[model samples]
Target: MTSTTQQHPLPLTGRIAVVTGAASGMGAAIAERLAADGASVALLARRTERLDDLALKIKAAGGEAFGVSVDVTDQSSVDRGAEEVRQRLGRVDLVVNAAGVMLGAPVQEARIDDWTKMIDTNLTGALRLAHAFVGDLVKAAAEGRTADLVNISSVGSRGAFPTHGVYSATKAALTQFSEAIRADLSPADVRVSSVEPGMTATELGANLSDEQLELLGSTFAGIPPLAPADIADVVAFVVSRRRELNLSYLVAVPTRQV
Candidate 1:
């Protein structure tokens, strides 16, 4: 007698995913990876051109993708972006808040503007996105679908670094926030995860001042930083876990880093 069993491939097939900061770096890589896993992805970022380019690339690869301009720091922008995703992809089953800024400097010498930008982008921006999509996440989970909220934090959140005072503070706040929300949401089966990545090769540090860069460069001297795809892989693993499993907090750093 032949046994009959259903074989399913592609874990995220038919899932609708919304990724912020999808125009570049880890965000872009995560969006692409999710699409490849069979999710219809909505790419959100202020850079419309880059989002368009990524969307096109995903489509060419036979994956579903839509690009939308979203400034996470702006409540109205986030709301509008959420609406666009809902209209284009139906209810969202996954939300990844990857928008962040790392402007490092000695606290005394730091530009107030830089601190504000980090707080707004790295902390409050994540809150905005969460607020806009928590309902959908809860509903999806209640309906027995996978629902995930992933926040991209930093290893800087775990300790003090010479020039990363305010930056570290913001990330620390984000990490704590993720924990608090996870407590509230996990009971509903909505997974909330914080991904804290250590030194990574991305445009995240491109805007740093020369002094800060030199300081960071020496600090990470011989260690090869992680690639965006590495973080993307972690995210994919987290969201693809079984419904009963939730990898809540993950810190990903280079193997050689102390």
Candidate 2:
């Protein structure tokens, strides 16, 4: 077996993890994987029913997960969610900043409101989590434990694709922020990285207009798109390694996604 596929027990068992936007898609997948690998997971999202369903599934499978509801764009909501996790799980060892939104409105017709929503959810959301969780991650690091702050970035960060101007900007900002944190937190042993995904089959595009979604569907029709599970697989690999091992950055996109 390849080293990656070989039997590796959960390196993060007993370690707490907080995943935002955990109701569905990549967030849900990552939460499931981490719990499967023995980490106690805190699931955060705007929807409680979905979160509850996911949490029940985890419990059924003998893994631990707590359902939480928080609007990432709201500071109080974010703070309250973090506090709840702290009270329940004791310490947070991993944070996957996955709460995000994308509305494909061309610059000409795009409302300022839509732009603000993207900026708030995709960019500010990640920042709020980092600000709230960094102190705990540092404390974990001081105890000789490696904590991770993995930001879910996008390939859109590097280019302006048609109506994707605002969305691209948010992702680009997130990528830059992840890089900056890694550089600044070296002494704290907090590993920061961005997982940039391209052409994944998730509800991430659900916010786009019907026409835009149709266009995207046509554009990716021929490709074998990556699933949320694929992204989760990569995340599990990154988190299961020894404290010294760090996955600086990972860009997992479809091979035919050009």
Candidate 3:
């Protein structure tokens, strides 16, 4: 008989978790995983219709899920969306800032507009969600509830690619920002964690041009691209930890990649 390691499933019954960018890709996968583990999930993204569809699916499957429409680039929109989630869900225990945009362009031809959009959507976007949710997390901590704030980063944050310069910088900034928040929130029971995944197979890379996609292809060819669910599993594990054990950082990649 072959021996296999059994993974620990997260216990999240009745807990409330909010996931941004939950319309599709890793965001959707993460939301589904949390709901499956017994948490009530609130999905947020720019596409309200998509969010509605996902929420329907989760509800059909006998899970608790609610969807909200939000644009992370707009601070006021994020603020309102957060409050709406709080009102509907009653409380928030976990917040995942998974909303983002990626732009690949050479420095010479990359429009400043593209760069600005990338910054606003990727870096500042996370900032907006975190700011809006920090209050809820603090409240949970004060009440001695288990809480978490997870920011998705990327291996590109450290790896240098020909056209990935701008996008990489944005993810790197997210990592640093998460670190600072982790330190600041340490006194409270709220845990801040960063998860960095490499070459994931998701819509996240759909923004690339043909040539840019080819470039990414070469770097990822030998390595098996991880599905969005893999990253979601990592996050689930982090949150499942005892309140006393804070998972500060997690880096997961396909085994073949290394």
Candidate 4:
């Protein structure tokens, strides 16, 4: 008697993913998870050393990954990074705009520079990346493959909080932009999604002021915040769905934060 054996295919096999802010935190986790899901990943961030190390680890784990030093705030840098990813990993099938900054200050004492930085990185940076790789995404979709654009937003976008004015505004804008672009890209089979995470144990709070830091600390003193891996899991799920379905809007927050 002859026996037949079957091999299961990886969900993201032969796909290429580009993750901004991949040097650490949620971006790093997302990159790693995508690589694990059989997608070749390009890690983009300002921290070349961190990216390099991450790439090494991914490669060592029998996955394909490359690190590109990119400052999302600069159009030229974004263009160059996108070109490099195409050259290295072929056309990008997935792009995650995860590079962002959160600097909280009351409106009365808000620093113009901080707000500007937030806008540049959170709103404009996402736009720059979208503009640069959108054509690539279109091409990928035209090839009858799944293509996705995932934007990392914050729950602050939907809620009001002291000192989170500008940060929240940027996230809100990102959410709206994602919805608009999703409609535009749907014809090309490219799906756009915005993920809003309430709180996660990452470096996002390092830039917070003393008062903001204290507020955060006291707010979740005993509650364990969501982990970077938690958000990464959601991102992976959003992009891994069947080509016919799209998970447009998702909010993942700690249950206790409810």
Candidate 5:
């Protein structure tokens, strides 16, 4: 199969992008894919080592990428990271709010701390980056260039699942936030989109308890999950489109994920 890197032309040449949670999983894949499509990508995460390693890989692939150490939950950290990205990559034309956490537990057993963590990272973290980078996005659009903000949501946002209440809430809120931002930014020619993916194989749920794991295992037992690359491909397509079409919302799931 021809890889997306090899298949997609460089539509994002001269563009700059920021991707949070870029140390691994879909964030890493999206960062690499964006670079491949000819954007200079900034990889942001708490793990400097992983971000460095991913940056090296993108550079090896003839794509431009840099690592920025950031804790998405911290506003000051996000501010610093955004400034660094501006310094390093010039200006941000695209931003991906991929930093997120999923903690699963029954409502009765769920810890308040876990709920707080989810709300902070998944919702507020995304909001912070958006707030910090709006000026850059608006500037790019004003300069006759297309600017984009892509938020990564989840299938859980579409419906309720046992032990996934808080996680689902966060994602659903993100989707709504994206729509509102899209409307608000339309006059500026800055595009906003939400990408919701389902049942992808990633470490997102690695922290789940044994019971949660068992439930997931039984739920997805014979079904194949979407790869990180699959979702990345969709993201690249959305952001790469011509400015006339918004390509606002998408929900991609494994064919068997019903």
Candidate 6:
């Protein structure tokens, strides 16, 4: 008797993925998940030590991974990181822009520097990454491979929060930019997606002022926060879809969140 059933290869099996902010939190989770799914992952962040630690763990788990020191706030840094990924891992077919900062304070009391940091990291950073890798993504798509650019936005983009004005603005801008680029890239068979998560459990708020932290704690007092792995799962699902299908935008939140 001939056995007919056969195992299918992993969806991302031969793809190359790059994840920014990969030292911790959502970015780290996403990189790990992608690598486990069979893609060669390049972890990018300013924290070289953390990235190296993550790379070692991924390799130990039988996944291919390498760490690259990248500061998304700097164009030169991003360009260099992209070059390294290309030279080491081949053309990138998956790029996840997950680097961000959330420094919350009352509008009137908000430090100008905080606002600048947020804008530079959460908005311009995403743009720098997209510019550095869009060509590779396009080439991958043209070669009949699944190509994706996923941006991590936030539900705050659509709702008003007491002390998250600037943060929300950056996310809102990200969402809009994601949509515009989707339009431009869809014709080339490149999938672009914006994933908005609500109240995820991560270090995104570690830099908040004590008062703002208190407010943040109270706002989600009873609602359980989503985990980084949760967002990573969403991203994996989005990119694993058939090349002809696109999950353009998604909002992920805990059920307890109103």
Highest lDDT scorer: 6
TM-score winner between candidates 1 and 4:
4
After superposition, the stretches of candidate 3 with alpha carbons farther than 4 Å from their true spots are 1-10
User: C-alpha displacement of 131 in model 6, angstroms?
Assistant: 0.3
lDDT string, candidate 2, 1-258, tens digits = 655656766667777899998999999999999999999999999999999999999999989998989999999999999999999998798999988888897788968999999999999999999999999999999998779999999999996588889899999999999988899887789899899989888898887889998887787788998999999998888888887878978899999987
In terms of lDDT, model 6 sits at 0.95
lDDT of 3: 0.89
Misplaced by over 4 Å in model 2 are: 1-9
Q: Against the correct fold, how does model 6 do in TM-score?
A: 0.98
Q: Write the per-residue lDDT of candidate 3 for residues 196-234, one digit (tens) a residue.
A: 987788898787899989987887788878999999999
Worst 10 residues of 3 by lDDT: 7-16
Local accuracy by lDDT, each model: 0.93, 0.91, 0.89, 0.92, 0.93, 0.95
N/CA/C clash count, model 4: 0
Superior candidate under lDDT, 1 versus 3: 1
What's the residue-level lDDT of 76 in candidate 4? 89
Checking candidate 3 for backbone clashes, the offending pairs are none
> For model 1, what is the alpha-carbon lDDT of residue 97?
91
Q: Which sections of candidate 4 miss by over 4 Å?
A: 1-5
Using TM-score as the measure, the top candidate is 6
Clashes of 2: 0
Decide which is better by TM-score, 2 or 6.
6
Enumerate residue pairs that collide in model 5.
none
Ranking by TM-score: 6, 4, 1, 5, 2, 3
lDDT tens digits by residue: candidate 5, 1-258: 875654545788888999999998999999999999999999999999999999999999999998999999999999899889988879898999999899999999969999999999999999999999999999999999999999999989988789999999999999999999898999999999999999998889989989999998897888899999999999999998998788899999989888
Global Cα lDDT for candidate 2: 0.91
Question: If candidate 6 were superposed on the true structure by all CA atoms, what would the RMSD be?
Answer: 1.1
